[model samples]
Target: MADRTSKKPPTTRKTSLYRLTDDGDPDLRSLIRPRYLDQEGFRARPVRQGPLRGLLVTGTTAPGPADWCQALADLTGLAVNEENHTAFGLLIVRTEKHIYALGHGMGHLMIEPARIDPGFGIHFAVRCLEKDRVTKVRRQIMDARGRSDENSVTSGEHIRGFGIEEFGEIVSHIAGKVRGIPLTYTGGDAAGAHITGNDRSVKLRLGRTPEDLMNDLLAIEEVCERDDPLPEFDFITQVRPLEAVSDLAQGLDARLDEMLGTGVPGRVGLAVPSECREGFDSAETFRVRVARRTRTVPELDAQTLLGPVSSCAPGERLETLRKGKVQMFADSDAEEVISGNVSAGRWLTAEVVEEGAHYFLWQGKWYEVGAEYLATVKRRVTELLARPSRITLPPWPKGEGEGPYNEKRVAARAGYVLLDKKNVHTARLHGGGWEVCDLLGPDGQLIHIKKAPSGTAPLNHLFAQARMCVETLKYDTGARRKFIAKLDEIAPGHPARDFREPTVVLGILLKEGEPVTADSLFSFAQISLLHTDNVLKGLGARLEVVSIGR
Candidate 1:
């Protein structure tokens, strides 16, 4: 027995991070860990399902059937058994809208002559065991063996006795029953499978799908499911023309054989007749004609023509045959003649020569012609002429200063200046407002200056004077002592950083051929001069050293 007490009012609400299924079971965990969850305290929620579709089809053929069985297996993945002459397999047919399949298998049977009434040689029974819809069926037959069977062979006498009309009727009856059935021809009786004809060939027929077949068959289970139902048809029914069907079946069989071989059909080549050749005088033209059939001149027959000749130059003359003999003359000199003739369409020979205004006696008559006429005759004789010569130019000059005048120095001398301090003097020169000079220090180290100078100062001369001062002061004890005392009193900081009132910077140019010393105090004094130069150069100002005192 338990005692009950009044419940207290709820103070807060609770929220859940874990999710449960519709049946209240905890949701399952993921098989893989998520990258963001590597920190160890993360979880994933449930996802929803979407739509899906698929399909399948299965079929089988009779045992001992070669061509059709092999073709079906290759194209549709159906399996076949020789002993059964039957096949059983499936097709997984898929499309965007849905997934489905069809499964089927069948056995074959031979009909007795009595039952196959019209007496067709042999009759085969085919049945559709399962399908989504009625399928199209095609049939064909060939000699399973290369020759007729001895056991089933009929004598010509028996065939004649049966009568042509009777035999025709038997064939008709057999064809009618096989019309919609899927059939194949093989060597031997129903037991042994030998493909007939060349490589045991036969015609292939397309089968109608179950949907288009008899309505009863269309009610079979969906393509994706397995369902069985038997549909029967007579084996002696009349079929359409077999010759056309046979041709198609044979083609399909051939394609199958090709596919089985190298997985691709072999290619065949075609033949093309060679073209007629054309002739020309130049070997270049002849070679071209051989490779590419191009005739430069239509009238120049390959059998009779020769060269491409040219006429005389301007103001040239040649002899004119006005009446078959050298009759008239014309100005200038004549050039060469290019002419040729053909013989028997086989060989071509040509000649070239120069023609002038005057010629020796021919047939006892001296002939004279104007230069112009000779030139014209020369032009007519030569079928073509070489191009004119080109003009030559003089060579270029080799050494510097041998060409144009250079004003680079004029631009360099724009600014100049001179400075003096405590009887010490210096000078500077500017080009393009830039300093260019060689500087020296007290310790004998030469310093080179090459930069834009400040304002109007002669930067080069100023540098030279500063260098001379350093060197001159180095050997004079009294002067050095005084300079050192002045430097010690002056701060070595930049102008902007110097807090001392009346700070004066001395701008000096070290002279050429002077020396520089490694003494720290002396170096400092020289550095101060360099700093002063930099400040003046940056500000575009000019400066002069006034004095050096103790």
Candidate 2:
């Protein structure tokens, strides 16, 4: 009799593979959705013969009208409502020490999002033999400063030329927090792998047939067994979604509450997580509700946030308030709930470098900063501290605001011209309205003063303000002329009349208990200041950071 279990011949067809996380539930039945199993033509059974020899789920999506059917109907003047079906399959392969899933067509939809390991593919890609020869790479890096609500992507031929060292330099920049989303590399005896950010799985373009898929799986398992060849890529590591509920998260939450409850101006705030979806752009205000009460606020701040959080019953934990959502509306009363939580921690700027564990919260997600990166941040802060300032101004009085202090009081005491609110308009600059500085000294010192904020947002704003003014004066002739004219108006025969390159002083007024240390300032704030320092220096102007108040 012929052998019942006959091996199928391998064919050249592409396939994608996902490794189930060790901590995730291994039962394939639990991971798959019931609706997918019930789909027409769906089949779930054990593979009788193959290298994988595990449970296989094969099916086609229920026939649906093709997306271009209506368009085709109009063009052809005939009934063109053609039905389309997507063939998909998932094979659960179990090895001695690992459980893996192979997705064919739309087979990825068969597994639960939470179960697949997010870093498995990237690990294999980095360790693969052809790691040096990369064809295409997709990277995501967020603006360290909160100036933008978008994550930028990088790709193309230029990426193809980059080696491991070049990739290191790109991610090491302080301006943004970068991550490799998906990287494709080829060369070295066989077809290469396409490592993707989607569950961090590897896609093999050459293994399309079931027999070929088993070969690819075996190759992947063998590659995964090796150690990572490039460790320099760990400048910024991802914090797993499940890990967010750990003790570190609890500490972060408590710190956020402390900052909000203390009523620090910039400690906690709100922002659009992403670009408003068309209609929401006109939203000028927000209605925040936590617990039973609601209040309207111009912008989210610590004081505004504290009210709603404090309104909860005495025994309620802050986590309970997360159920309440924030609403945004335009001119009409049609309010849309914008946020799923009111814990304030979701919007808080929490950066902690404790006991060698460095964590930064950016856009509501946590990232672990590598030791080398932490050292880089410390060096920046240290250099800024050691730089001497050419000008100094007294601190704001106990109950006075920064604007009032600069315009009303600091001018008389420091013998500096009050240039606060002296807006110089130029079409080329950032939004046009620009101030030379808060105060200008007789000796040509450009003094920019700001209250030392607990978070990076306000500090970054201050840094940008100073950087833009200097940049304007250096480049925009029209803006410089307008600034000089405004200066003469404020103080006749002012030293700025000869404003070639004045010393730019950044004066930060510290809170009573806050110290002037590297650890005291948020890491992103230091990065902003360093960036400002570099720009001002390039413009032939000296930059200095001074803590106001002895």
Top TM-score: which candidate number? 2
Clashing pairs in 2: 13-207, 13-208, 14-208
Give me candidate 2's TM-score against the actual structure.
0.71
Span of 10 residues, lowest total lDDT, candidate 2: 167-176
Counting clashing residue pairs in each candidate, in order, gives 112, 3
Per-residue alpha-carbon lDDT of model 1 for 28-88, expressed as tens digits? 2221123312423322333231221222222333335565667777888878634454443
Error of 1 at 131 (Å): 33
202-307 in candidate 2: lDDT tens per residue? 6655454455555556666666676543454343233222135445555765655454444343434332332222223345566766656777764444445455
TM-score of every candidate: 0.11, 0.71
Candidate 1's clash total is 112
